[model samples]
Target: MVRKKLYRSKKKLGQAPGSVVYTGERPKEKLFLEAFDFTKDTYTEKQLTNIEDCFEYKHTETVTWINLNGLNHVNAIETLGKHFDIHHLALEDIVNISHRPKLDDHDSYLFLVLKMLYYNNSHNLVSEQVSFILGKNYVFSFQEAEGDVFNPIRDRIKNAKGRIRSMASDYLLYTLIDAIVDHYFNVIEVLGDKIEDLETDVFTNKSSDNLSIRIQDLKREILRVRRAVFPLREVISKIVKNETNLIQNQTSTYFKDIYDHLTQITENIELHREIIGGLMSMYLTSISNKMNEVMKVLTIMASIFIPLTFIAGVYGMNFKYMPELEFKYGYFAIWGLMVIVFLVLLFYFKRKKWL
Candidate 1:
C-alpha cells in the first residue's frame, strides 16, 4: 500500500474532536464494500456497489461482515458510521489511520483499531490501519486499501470448512484478527531471514558497502513492527477482559489466543531489535579492526624504511667527507651492509611475530 507521512496535517489541526478526516496517503478512490452473511446452515456473499446495500444486514439474524476498503472517502465512512450508530470518534479514528491499536466498548458495539502488517509487492513491510466495529449480529471492518490478510477467513467461510461459519460475529472478529496476527509470523520470519543474512555479512566480512544502511533499515523495520504489535497486546487483553455482550465468553478464549500470539510477536520484535543493535556494533568494530590492520601495515613499512632512509640520507649528503665514501668498494660495501641490515630486521620481525 502507498503510504504518506502520518503526522496530522493542517487540514485536521484544531478541528473539533471526532471530526472525520482522511489522514492517509491513499487518494480519493471509489470505496469497495464486500458483505458476507453466514450461519450454520446458510451463506451468502455480495460485492456491494452501493454503501446502502450492506446497511440492511445490520438487522439480519445471520452473522454479517461488512468490509469497507478506502477510508480516504470520508463521506462514505461517515454515512456508514451514521447508519451503524458508530460514534463520531470511532469514525474519526478509522479515517485517521495513525491511531495505535485500541479497543473501545460502546453501548451497542465494540470499536477496535489494529495495525495490519503485510509485505507489499516490493517486499517492504507495510502497516495499514484496520478498524473493527463488532455489534449484535454484524461486524464492520474498515481499511485503507482493498487487499487484506483475511482471505483465509473468507475461504473458511465460503467452504464451511471451519467453525467460523457456525459461530457468532465475535468469533468472526477473532478469526479476522487471528489472520492478521498469524501473518505476523510470516513477517517476522522474513525479518529473521534478513537479520541472519546481515549477521553473516558482518561476521564473514562480506557485507555490502551499505551494510550500515541495511542494518539501520532493519532496525527501523523492527521498531515499526514493535509499534504496531505491542499496543495490540493490550487491545487483545481488553477484548478478553471486556464485559461487553458483543464479545462472547467463549470467543474470549480465541481472543486470548490472539493475545498470546501478540506476546510472542513482541518478544520476537525485541529480540530482533537487540540483534540489530549488536549487528551495528559488530559492523563498527569490524570497520575499526580493518582500519587498524591498514594502519599496522603502514606502521610496519615505515619502521622498516626508517634505518634505510637514514643510510640513504647520510650518503646523499654533498660533502665528500666520509672515509667510507672515499673507499674504493664503498658503494658495494654499503649495498651489502644495507642488505644485511634489511635481512636482519626482517628476521627479527618474523621472530617477534610482528610480520
Candidate 2:
C-alpha cells in the first residue's frame, strides 16, 4: 500500500484583533517590555507593564528604546501610535505578521521590518518577524516574543561601552539591524554544519530515506535564510545611500557596515547552495554505481549458466548418441567434460576481470 506523504505548509492565519499573528499556527499571547534610557554617562533599564508609564520619561532628551515583546495588545499599540504620532499603516504592519523584510519611510518616522532567526531545541531553524519604528528620539521595536538575540546589544548599551546609546535613533536602528543580521550568520553556521554532515553520509553510505529527508530539509532552510537575508542587503543599501534623512550621514557609515555583513551572508548562502547541489549529485552517482554493480553480477551469473543449460539439454535428447551409449563410462566422461568447460569459462572471466 502506498503511504500518504505529509508536508509542512508555510501559510499562516490572518491577523485578528488583539492576536499574536505569526507565519505558522496561532501562538500564545506573550508581552514583555524592556525600556532603555541612556545618555553619554548614565543609563537606566526598567521592565514596564503599563505603556503609560513609558510616557513619563519620553521627553527627557535621553535616547529611550521601548521594546515590545508581543504585538497582540492592540490597545497598547494604539496608545503608542497616538503618543508617538506613528503612521497608521506602520501600526497596521506591526500587527500583520506576514509583512516581508522591508523599509518604509514616512516624513516623521522610518518603518523597518526584519526577520529574526534562532535554532530551536530540535536543531531546526525558527524565525520571527521584528518591526522597528524610528521616531525623532525614541525607537520602538515590536517582536513576536521576548528574549530576542538582541541581548548582546542591550548589554553593550547598558555598559555604556559603545557609541550606540549616545547616538541618534538612526544609529540605534543600525545596531539593532546589525544584531539581527549577525544572527543570520549564526543560522548559516548551523546550516553549514548540517551540510557537512550530509556530505559525509552521502559519500560513505547508500541513499536512504533519512538522507533524502535531510537534504530536503537543508534546502528548505537555505531557502528560508535566503528569503530573510536577501532583501536586507537592499534595506541597508538604501540606508547607506541616505535615501531618507531618517538615517544621518554618520549613521550611514554604520549601515554600510551592515551592508557588508549582508553581502558576506549572501555569498555564504550561494556557497551553501553549491554544496547542496554537489551532495545531490553524489547521491545520484552512488545509486547509479550500486545499480551497475548489481547488473554486472547478474550478467556474469547468466553467462555461466547458459552453456551448462545447453550441454544438459543436448545430453537429455530422446534419441541417445550410439557411440556414447556403447561406452560404459559415457555418463562420467560427459560430466567431466562439462566440469572442464565450466572451469575454462571461469578462468577466462577471471583473466578479463569481468567476474
Candidate 3:
C-alpha cells in the first residue's frame, strides 16, 4: 500500500510545483464545506454545500473556521486559493493524499499537514490527511472526506465552551492540534487491548494458527501509527520554538503540552514494538519444544523394537542340521530369552532416564 501511494505521488514528478493533480483514490463521499464563525459572545456554525459561499466569512473579524472536507474538488480548492491568497504549493499538498505530515510556515498563514486515523465500520484502521491553513482571523481546515474526529471540538466552539471562543486564530490552531493529540491516547488504548488479547491467545490456546499473520498486521498498524505520530516531535518542536508571530507566546505553552503527549505516545509505540518482538520469539520457541517432545517419544519406541526384531530374524533362519529343531522345549526357551532381553533393555532405558 505504501508503494502504491508512492507510485501515485510520482505522477507529479516533472509537472509544475503547484499542480493540482490529486494523487489519491477518488472519494466516495461528496465534497462539503462547513463554516464556523464566532466571537466571544456570539456563535454561528453552518454547513456550506455551495463552495462559493465560503468567501463571505473571509472578511469577518470574528474567528472563522472554514473546514473544507473532501479534497476531490480541485476547482473549489483552487477557488479558495484565489480568494485567500494561499500558495499554490499549499493547495497542492492539500489535494495530494500522500503528503507526509509537515508544517509549512508562510508569510500570512501557517500550513500544517497531519493524518487523522479512525476505525471504519468494519473495524479496520483508516486514515485521512488533514491540512490546516491558519491565518490571522480565519482558519482553513481541509480533509479528504466529509467525516471527522473533531465533533467534540466543534461542540465546544458552538457553545463557547472554555476559552476557544475568546482566543485568537493561533489559539484555535492550538486547540485543533490539541484535539488531534488527545485522539492518539484513545488509539493507543484500543491497541493495548488488542495486544492483550493476542498475548492471551498465544500463550493459552494450543492452536496458535494464523497468529503470525495477525501479529504482522498489528506491527503494520503500529508502524502506520508511528509514522502518523512520530514526526510531530520535530514539527511541533519547530512550532514551539518558531520566531513566527503566527504562534503567540501564550499558545506556545499549549503546544508544549502537545509535544509532551507526543513524547509519551512515542515511548508507548516503542514498548509495543518490543512486545511484538517478544511474542515472535515465544512462538518460535513453543513450536521447537513441541517438535522435541514428539521426537523423544519416537526415539524411545525405536529403542524397544530394535532388539526384538534382531531375535526374530535369528530364529527365522531355519536349517536342516540345526540342533535346536529336534528339541520340543526349544520354542519355549527362545520365547523366554526374547522376553528377558526386552525387560533388560527396558530397565536400562528407565535407569538412564531416556524413556
Worst 10 residues of 1 by lDDT: 1-10
Query: Which digits, one per residue and each the tens of the lDDT, describe model 2 over residues 73-97?
Result: 7678878887877776677778766
Of candidates 3 and 1, the better by lDDT: 1
Instruction: Tell me how candidate 3 scores on lDDT.
Output: 0.85
Q: Which residue pairs collide, candidate 3?
A: none
lDDT of 3 at 252: 89
lDDT by residue (182-210, candidate 1, tens digit) is 99999999999999999899999985789
lDDT of each: 0.88, 0.81, 0.85
Ten residues in sequence with the least summed lDDT for candidate 2: 1-10
Residue 183 displacement (Å), model 2: 1.9
In model 1, pairs of residues that clash are none
Query: Model 3, range 206-282, lDDT digits (tens) per residue?
Result: 54678888888898988889999988788899988965779988998889999999999999999998998787777
In model 1, how large is the Cα lDDT of residue 143?
90
Q: Give the TM-score of candidate 1.
A: 0.95
Q: What are the TM-scores, per candidate, against the unseen true structure? A: 0.95, 0.87, 0.91
In candidate 2, which residue pairs get closer than 3 Å at backbone N, Cα or C atoms, i.e. clash? none
Best by TM-score: 1
